[model samples]
Target: MSNNKIIDLGSSEDPLVLDCGKSIGPIKTAFTTYGELNETKSNAILVCHALTGDQYVASEHPITKKDGWWSLLIGPEKSIDTNKYFVICPNVIGGCMGSTGPNEINPKTGKEYGLDFPVVTIGDMVKAQKLLIDSFGIEKLFSVIGGSMGGMLVLEWLSKFPSYVFSAIPIATTTNHSAQNIALNELARQAIMADPEWKSGNYNIENTKPVKGLSVARMAAHISYLSEQSLHEKFGRNLQNKNKIEFSFDADFQVESYLRHQGFKFVDRFDANSYLYITRAMDYFDLKAENNGSLIEAFKNTNSHILCASFTSDWLYPTSENKVIIKAFNALGLNVSFVEIETDNGHDSFLLDEPEFFQTIKGFLDATYKKL
Candidate 1:
């Protein structure tokens, strides 16, 4: 296993037509890898990150110096077992990380693309990932794994290239965004656009920032990512800042203070326009289209064994949503398994510390390790 934390693949500036009919760019995707691939090159596992997640899945964040989002699962001898499997994590296209996104400088405009960047879909992202895999000279993947938007990409990969992948594990995710999910995203988008400093998504390169609206949007979406129980456990009626209320229009609760910090930190590390684009892509995702207008048809040709897991409390992509996918696979007679881990982490369970989740993944991958 390599102790090095980061690997740069440089840039890939391939132009592409997004699902929205605009010709956008597929920018250079930076990725990180761990573990040593076997001679057969069959132990490679692609770990996809969720929305707002970057390529720092199992490594320290370059800017924050914080532990990687999935460090719990992807360490040398952890559940992901980097000592046994080569793991690859890439920053998705349209992301704010080193990957090309709305924040990238548009050669034509000589400025940040911002809203000018063309809209992209989940399929477009998977396609770019395929290119990256090819660059590594790997003929097939041992498994494709992810959660949230990353799970959406896993589904896309299975639908688009059923012949090449061996296994998939989609956690706390859905095939398509429900009306309720769409509404939540729309509200967040509205919050961002409502900001006067947004300046119609073309804010100049000045120190001026769009704080209020972005904070509100982050606050709202953050709530959706967490369950009520989680919020209560973390901040139950705790006072903010001072021991008692200031009796003024300010943060008076611990939750408010926490949200404010989250919102503020998010903007510093993420581009607002990229958030709008990525969330929109997720909102428009519809897997049925790939399966002859039915999800079962999509999995019909896949030989991959699936392990679909969800959190009992993940309302964002609840157990019911995971059942829909399992049912679709069963209808096609594909080998599939499902597990609904009970946790209060909500949609964010996959990223947090969950021993049961980690053990499940370890056992599943170990079951197929010999096949690789």
Candidate 2:
């Protein structure tokens, strides 16, 4: 039996409207829950997954048979202790793991949506998540937490439906995608599109996939998620299974081999079209532009306690980016905390076994729960 739960949301009467001026209905969302909802139903927490993450937050991933992505920080006695709080994690609408996306059959034509899938925005994603939360009758979430792209969703939740969130932690994320960020995403998209097998996103119909293009895209994107220090420490200039470079386009260095492994491994689980769509969404994310050119105005509706954390070596979304968020909260005089965790693990530090990060979240959540 699959470990996750699947729910069909939206209907003919109430279709999910996309930012692109399109509508879809009866969208399927795969999710998983941990712990139990208390009698008051106030201890519920929403955990948004990152771009490549699914609903397997604290359980085994059915595909890879690997431990949940955020297992390090969630469990019976972990930071977001399930014993004390109920956790709800749902696959985003544009996800491939049993969610409505390009890989799924379109009800209108009964074939894969492919390029025909409606473009989704961060706001659209948060809107879909709200439906799932409402399904559980959760009036206000005890906390909504995530890192990286997941963090962007948290910000969207705070901005669009402030009253529904009690507290939030947006880690290793920015208010908007920087120019460099957009450039990197474009590079990945081009890589996928350049593959001959892509066939304008109709590879599925041909019983083929642009695995080479997708793998290269994943490799390039994965590098941005790490710091130079971490890379040097982990692989450096070491040769890959050889005493010296006998290489002529082969993976001569360990770093190249490592990245190749990561890239190829990722292709086995992720969908190429999904990657294209999600990256485009990230590139289009801009809180300032969305809220009349004012980041503070974007969050003015929120009264929730917020904590923003960043890694010192995370050039992808540096501490400065995170501070912009804190500055907005500060301008609004909202209860907020900022932590620049000292780590060289880069943007992926939040996903690693960083004790300081763990303790910080644990303390903040404990304090927030007490206030509840």
| Lowest lDDT 10-residue stretch of candidate 2 | 1-10
Candidate 1: residue pairs that collide: 12-28
Q: Which model scores highest in lDDT? A: 2
Backbone clashes in model 1: 1
* Tens-place lDDT digits, model 2, residues 1-372: 346999988996799999999999988889999999999999999999988888999999887988999999999999999999999999988899988888999999999999999999888888899999999999999999999999999999999999999999999998899999999999999999999999999999988889999999999989999999999999889999999998499999999999999999998999999999888888889999988999989999999999999999999999999999999999999999989999989998988999999999999999999999
Task: Provide TM-scores for the models.
Answer: 0.93, 0.99
C-alpha lDDT score of every prediction, in listed order: 0.83, 0.93
Model 1 per-residue lDDT tens digits across residues 276-332: 999999998998865568997777778887888999989999999889999888888
lDDT, residue 78, model 2: 95
* Model 2 lDDT at residue 344: 88
Which residues of candidate 2, in runs, are more than 4 Å off?
none
lDDT of 1 at 35: 86
